[model samples]
Target: MTPPANAPTFLAQHGWEGAEIQPLAGDASFRRYFRVLSEGRRAVLMDAPPPHEDPRPFVAVAEWLAQAGLSAPRILARDLERGLLLLDDLGDSRLRETLDIAPEREIELYEIAVDLLVHLHRQPPMSGLRPHGLDQWLDEVSLFPDWYCPAVGLDVDGAGFRDAWTAVLRPVANDGRAPVTVLRDFHAENIMLVDGRAGVEHFGLLDFQDAVAGHAAYDLASVLEDARRDVTPSVERAMLKRYKEAAGEGERFEAAYWALAAQRNTRILGVFTRLWKRDNKPHYTNFQPRMWGLLERNLAHPALGPVRDWFDRHLSAEHRAAAWAQAA
Candidate 1:
């Protein structure tokens, strides 16, 4: 794809005139990224067009992560009004790509990724971040009924679904444990394996513009129980054990981990379906089976009784398969 009309002016103003700009792979969000090469140096230009997307939150969070000694992209320059940012080129070695080439490194890579989260969780609560608690979880999961159910011809009782989620998620929202900065999309695709970096810094974080002050377990679940790729049960189990031991949270951590996993996967089901039905991005549906499997695994936990019952009553086996089959 061609760069935006103003991209040349933007680059020229930043002393990158005549730079080679090539489109980089985009994520599920509206933001677009480009790799820029000028003067034998490389940088990434983020084109977060206005109205649909904003760059300020990303700027703030990037600063926060940098201050915390994490490997977030350095903001070389920015034009928030124009929704554009020139950032340090973190390179093309995403954990996903690296793992695809060297599956043997999955455990090693995930340990580093988990250690990064463990480090973040130990830090004091971040200021200026929104809470990703009960209300947020409910609002996200509602997308399933709002978009997916209708698209799959399943008549859903939206109020009932919300109530069910509320019952299960209320304790989580009210839990006394202090919230930490949750990088809302901490998955393999969003993590770059930086060479020559030490410890957790070896993992370059991305797509964290939506970071929130939420339960630590949310990001953990986002990583281990990813929607875009299959993280083997053994790896998931090992990572969970590593996190629990490293954070020293014990059984409480286990409960929160499964609960958040259920919530995240539930929300993804709707989000993916919405991408297909509303955004015309049907490829997202391809992950429905994996999402459903993760949801089921989490819902099996006794703590998720209400949510399990809710699914049992509202989403019959056939109804569930209807959505899955659509993707297949």
Candidate 2:
């Protein structure tokens, strides 16, 4: 992996002086991060060049999480103008990579994750971390038809899919009470198991630049219906119930769970497609089948009448069969 032209000077100007920079391999995005070793200490240098990415969101959200007592990679120094930052190296182990340790230990580690999410949701709504405006959501969600359909070569029944998405999402995005903090990508891969003061626990929250105020269910849906791992049905149910008990009952809260799951899963469909077509990342293609199952799960709720009907008509077995062939 080649370092971008300016990375050496950029890292050196910051506290990474005399540090040896080496690429950290294996990620889907164009962003490149490095392991900086110096004086028996280590840090990470995140290099995000423009057009491909903007580091402002990560900067903003990391500060927010830090204020909330969550462990974010501490910014040792930065040159935001050049898109470089030396951060505390949380370590090399991620929760996904450590799952083989012990089944009971894995479950315990994930429980801490559930708690972090609950704490974030309890905070008052805030906007700087995520794209929160209704117009923004509509504009972003609307792009699904444009990007996803063509990417996989689906002769998308565009009007059909759009209508279902609108029917499923409009209510929550329009409501005042539906608002809550959301860590848009709360999942295993972004978490690292660390040695906590009390005991061994997961630390090092990463890729949370998209945290924002949204429907309470948004992050929960991200956790339960993850993109990277197939968490079992029993685990999913247990987590959902724990959250429900923690958040307590209200008709609107329950309704938001179904509505938010539908909205998030729909967005995942568009995102997964874009990853393959625009980003040229094929690994995400492996998850399309499960993504469809999530879509269907959302539809099964009676509140999603229009979504259910749309899936029955559009993304049925016949539709996927053709789409898979096109993808191949």
Candidate 3:
């Protein structure tokens, strides 16, 4: 994780003449992160190189989330043309790892996260953002048939797959509740526990450049039905109840939560496959079984009948998680 060629110049311009750069982490995307230490100060350097990645939307959304009183990282400096950004260090205490080390805090930490969503959904959706409504939902889930089916050597009914998702999601789209800002990738890994901040401010947000003006239930579902981690069913149920009660939502929200959770899991199945096959990231295959588990649970919901039936007709038990287990 070498720093980009112009990183030293960028740091020098930002008044950090001799910073120590250490690799932080990379995600499923082309974006890379590094920790910068100079004197006694620390910051994060985001390398979102041109053509493959852009840093502007991240800047805009970070500002929007901050203005909304959420804990998105503060952008210290940026060079959009070269796709470099210096951001406040949110530290290494990720929500996922925190839970891993102390399972007893699951409910407490999750309740705070749920409370953050309740607060975030109260605000109006940010202006000038793309909508992640029915159309986007359908488009995204297509990746399952587009990539996953082919990878498993199982021919699926692509048209039927779309029809099933549409049948399930159309009602969710028209469920009368207005759209809120959907932090499209609001999972445990993308969250950090800031040391000094208290309450919801303690949880810093990340990987939200794809934030959309979409269903309020979407982010809630994303956090609970995570692909990389096993959120016990009891915890998921508790958190769902927690969010619904806090937000004053009822049956319709429940329906949309399961429907969108299935939609998201289905899309991720294909996304991880695409990452492995096309993007040369085979390690993503390890998450497929977990995705399958979440999707299976989601399909059991009454609203997802069409999608469930479609899966039964096309994808079999052997073709699902079992296949991925072998691949992994």
Candidate 4:
């Protein structure tokens, strides 16, 4: 994937003339990133081509998060018509890679992440974002039956799947906790460990364009029960306790956490499979077992009885993680 045709013109117009452009990364979406080295300055160029991609939401959320005192990337320049953006480079030290290299920093780093959520929840959610509640949850989990089941040779009951999810998630949607800004993709891989920044600022947020006004526990569950990496049971427990204590949440939060974790993991199971089958990104299959592990743990919660029972009857262990073992 080369940079957009007019990326140089876009960069030059923004004073990044003749900068060295190097491919950085492309995420699950159509967006591609490039590192720009101009003179002594460094920046990241976002190529979010039109029709299939848009930069407006990203710009809106990034600006909103910055205004709310979070470390979202600064938008230096943008050409929304062409779906291009030049942003302050948040650097290369991702929390996921950092943890892989230094597992010892797990507790310390995760605490800071939890604290950032604690602080974020204290603020009013950004206005005009989509609501993520029972309806959204039901729709998201539908991906499992719609994609995953068919991919693995199971013709599971779609109605039963939706009903089971509705039973478990309806309460969560009405849990009465105030909504917070949910960085929908909050996870280790999307976090940057910035240098010279202390406290929560050390964690530069990314991939948050799809943020919505949603349950506070949603993002907590997202980070603690990460889909891409293993978070030790003890560490997960510690962080859950830390968030509950800091956020003044109790039993309801715990229940919501598990329920939402299962919802997220289930959705990701289908999503990763879709990425493989429909999108031709076969590498995502490698995360299926990990997703199954996380989902099974979430299903173990007593409150998720209906959802768990649905899975138990429909998907056997061999059809669950074992089905993906070879792919992993």
Ranking by lDDT: 3, 4, 1, 2
List the lowest-lDDT window of 10 residues for candidate 2: 193-202
Backbone clashes counted, model 3: 0
lDDT score for residue 21 of model 1: 96
Taking all chains together, each candidate's TM-score versus the true structure is 0.97, 0.88, 0.98, 0.98
Q: In candidate 1, what residue range of length 10 has the lowest lDDT sum?
A: 319-328
| Tens-digit per-residue lDDT, 276-320, candidate 4 | 888988788888878988988999999999999999899887789
- The runs of at least 3 residues in candidate 2 whose Cα sits more than 4 Å from the true structure, single-residue gaps closed, are 25-29, 127-137, 151-153, 197-201, 321-328
CA RMSD of all predictions: 1.3, 2.7, 1.0, 1.0
Q: Report the alpha-carbon TM-score of model 3 versus the true structure.
A: 0.98
CA lDDT of each prediction against the hidden true structure: 0.88, 0.70, 0.92, 0.91
Give candidate 1 misplaced runs (Cα > 4 Å). none
Error of 2 at 172 (Å): 2.5
lDDT of 2 by residue, 1-328 (tens): 6766776776677755667888885465656788888889888888877777778778878877777767788888877777777788888777777765555565566666777777777766556545564555556665556766666455667777666666666776666665676777877788876666322234668887667767777777777777777667687767777777877746666676776676666677677777777777756667777777776776787888986776676455755544434566
